[model samples]
Target: MPDYGFERIGKRLFAEHLVGGNFGNMSVRDGDAGFFIKKTGAYLDAPGEPVFVPFEGPVPKDASSEYRVHLAVYRTTPYRAIVHAHPPYAVAASLVTDEIRPLDSEGEMFCPTIPVTTGAPGTQGLANAVAEEMRHNKLVIARGHGTFAAGATLDEAFLLTSLAEHACKVIALKKMFLQ
Candidate 1:
């Protein structure tokens, strides 16, 4: 069965232009078992066919390498959903700083101070990095990767991701003016 909440999350991500092509993933917790994440290689456009792998045991073999990041956030925070994306401005901001400090209310509200995680794909190292950073805030940058946001529901997660991207874009434009 299709998880309607997740499908809506995917659609919202697409609407925000946070996801382009097949780049990005989102997940929602599955009660006590774990979480259900989008399958590897699934794009936002094909929400109906999106994979919903259960994370009951270890991360599923076909789970997105970024799944560890989601697991880490959910484990460390009260978050029930996560949205990770390569939003151009946010990814650009991540690459520019080893740390991202919120320069506006949007950032202050959802992220405040964001940490940059370390590790190769699918490794616990990145998860640990995110976990440590998330102890202080709900958002973190994945170094060369992308941005991640977690919340109590898919809508909240998606909203935070959108806010983060918007904040990043505004910050980038402000920097341009300063230059």
Candidate 2:
């Protein structure tokens, strides 16, 4: 398994409050071989080693449960790294809207529109939805689940993931203030 910047990104995810405990996962593409993913239930903040999963054959039991989404994404898009995080504001925003239109300038520029996709966690349905969206958009939020951001590298993907939470947090606060 390669660094692909997971250690740094993992720390950001935890510090930014995008994920709690071991709820989120990440991966980096490995060409024809497969991908290097966080092990199931591994702490993102201090993930020691990553597990590899091949394109064919059985997936390792220890692989993150969300590996299916990562595999589907790599198979369909040119992105090299994928970050899946359960951003509180993003998930809360997804619960009420079909999409998130950021009010902040940075959000508007980098992630002006984040579509909320629907599918159960760790299922093929979720994988397909996220993969298809990732083909065109770098960031997507599974309804009430989390945010999935794809990029050329883990750093890039991590940026999108962070931006997503920032955008959603602003939107949520705005809505709350207005109400």
The model with the greatest TM-score is: 2
lDDT per residue for candidate 1 within 60-177, as digits (tens), equals 6667767877777777777787888878787788777877776888777767767767666567897888767776766777777777777787778778778778888878888899
How well does candidate 2 score on lDDT at residue 118? 91
What TM-score, over all chains together, does every model reach?
Answer: 0.86, 0.96
Clashes by residue pair, model 2: none
**Regions more than 4 Å wrong, model 2:** none
Q: Supply the global lDDT for candidate 2.
A: 0.91
| Cα lDDT listed for each candidate | 0.74, 0.91
RMSD of each: 2.3, 1.1
Which 10-residue window in model 2 sums to the lowest lDDT?
1-10
Which residue runs does candidate 1 get wrong by more than 4 Å? 1-4, 49-59
The number of clashing residue pairs in model 1 is 0
lDDT of 2 by residue, 102-134 (tens): 999999998889999999999999999999988
